[model samples]
Target: MDLDRASSELNEKLSAIGGTANVAVLKSVVTQASSAIPVMPLYIAMVFKKMREEGVHEGCMEQIYRMFSQRLYKADGTAPEVDDQNRLRLDDWELRDDIQQHCRDLWPQITSENLKELTDYQEYKDEFLSLFGFGIEGIDYEADVNPNVAFDVIDI
Candidate 1:
């Protein structure tokens, strides 16, 4: 069977289990499996767009800050919250019902022509480029730099 069919069957099986939570898990799995599947990239793009519109989009720095300040080192010394499986739920915001529902509602309406109009593909591309320091601000990509520059290592 083709990937889309397999994905559809998986959705059917998950739906048979009868829970929105299970669907959410399926969506997460699909998003993570984007490398192997074709449609998942589009799904991820839509999800990211929805997240940005909701004002809950977070980059690596923001997520790390939350993990450190809220989870790892709380001022009250309380233990970090975990799910039933004893896993940190740092992705709680992205897995929210409203966000997922918005993506679900928009998924069917997306097409190659409407991709930019319906999704945050441009922002996604920019963020992906920024990972390699390409689109960052205040940096001269054309400037020459010494490859062996040494810096002090401070251990805390």
Candidate 2:
């Protein structure tokens, strides 16, 4: 997959954010979300691990807020720059030079033996399942907790 082109596109996107940008895009080769996708799981894991070490990560809400409330607005809050399709390109931050360089260095060195130590695969898997009410951290599924409750009703 055109790695150079991808890198260039990432850099171009990041540069779109002029001064006063609230978010920066960072490239990730792997994340919990991509674990199930074939052909690149190990690469993704290594990337995720590297990024975590660098303290660069953003969830869905943080990204959306930065897009409209921060990057899109001018200094005086008068206007937002948009393309012909009225879209704010937030993916640019991921292509920054430092991030790209780190990923490139890690790409060839990752292996199955060191995967667990380097990546947060198990942690991410737990978090992903917890979202759907499975494998929650504190609450025990096998506990005697009751799911049914009674509410008072009055007939008029």
Candidate 3:
């Protein structure tokens, strides 16, 4: 992966917002992509739109919570799995009103922005590569996986 190209793309988009993006941050975002390509632009759009609507801006913890919660999100885009049972287990209490409102506000914008930016198959493939750790930092994937390792519980 050409980090220089990825870094340039990340800075270019951030520059439009009068902000600076560092390599570490870029690498983190790039690593999250499903493809090896830098997906910062898509992230920027998603984050900006979500911040506008959600009112409750999320840090990493909130991000993980929402993402994990939405893994079973419905086909109609509703929080199908975040029921009382889930809320009680996941949070200290039941599904709080504030949480519902936040999701209601942000989900639409997140969905719309992602749909808009990631509709292309080429882009999808690139994004997927990054998701699987292809474009991330501190990972020299050029060294091949040890094919000799096996699922065997003991030496045969």
Score each candidate by Cα lDDT.
0.68, 0.58, 0.44
- A best-first ranking of the candidates according to their TM-score comes to 1, 2, 3
- lDDT digits (tens) for residues 1-156 of candidate 1: 354455556656777775212111122322223535776667667887787889887766677688778866798988666565434567887889999899888988888899999998777666556656677888888999989988999999
Question: Where does candidate 1 stray beyond 4 Å?
Answer: 1-37, 132-156
Instruction: Provide the RMSD of all predictions against the true structure, rounded to 1 decimal.
Output: 11.6, 9.2, 21.1
Candidate 3 residue-wise lDDT, 57-100, digit = tens: 44346655654564333356553343322221232111246544
lDDT preference between candidates 2 and 3, better one: 2
Better of 1 and 2 by lDDT: 1
User: Candidates' TM-scores?
Assistant: 0.61, 0.54, 0.24
The TM-score that candidate 1 achieves is 0.61
Give a tens-digit lDDT track for model 2, residues 7-94: 5566567777742322233344334556567734555555556555666665567666776676665567875654443345565445
In model 2, the Cα lDDT at residue 49 comes to 61
lDDT of 3 at 8: 62
- Evaluated against the true structure, the overall lDDT of model 3 is 0.44
Best by TM-score: 1
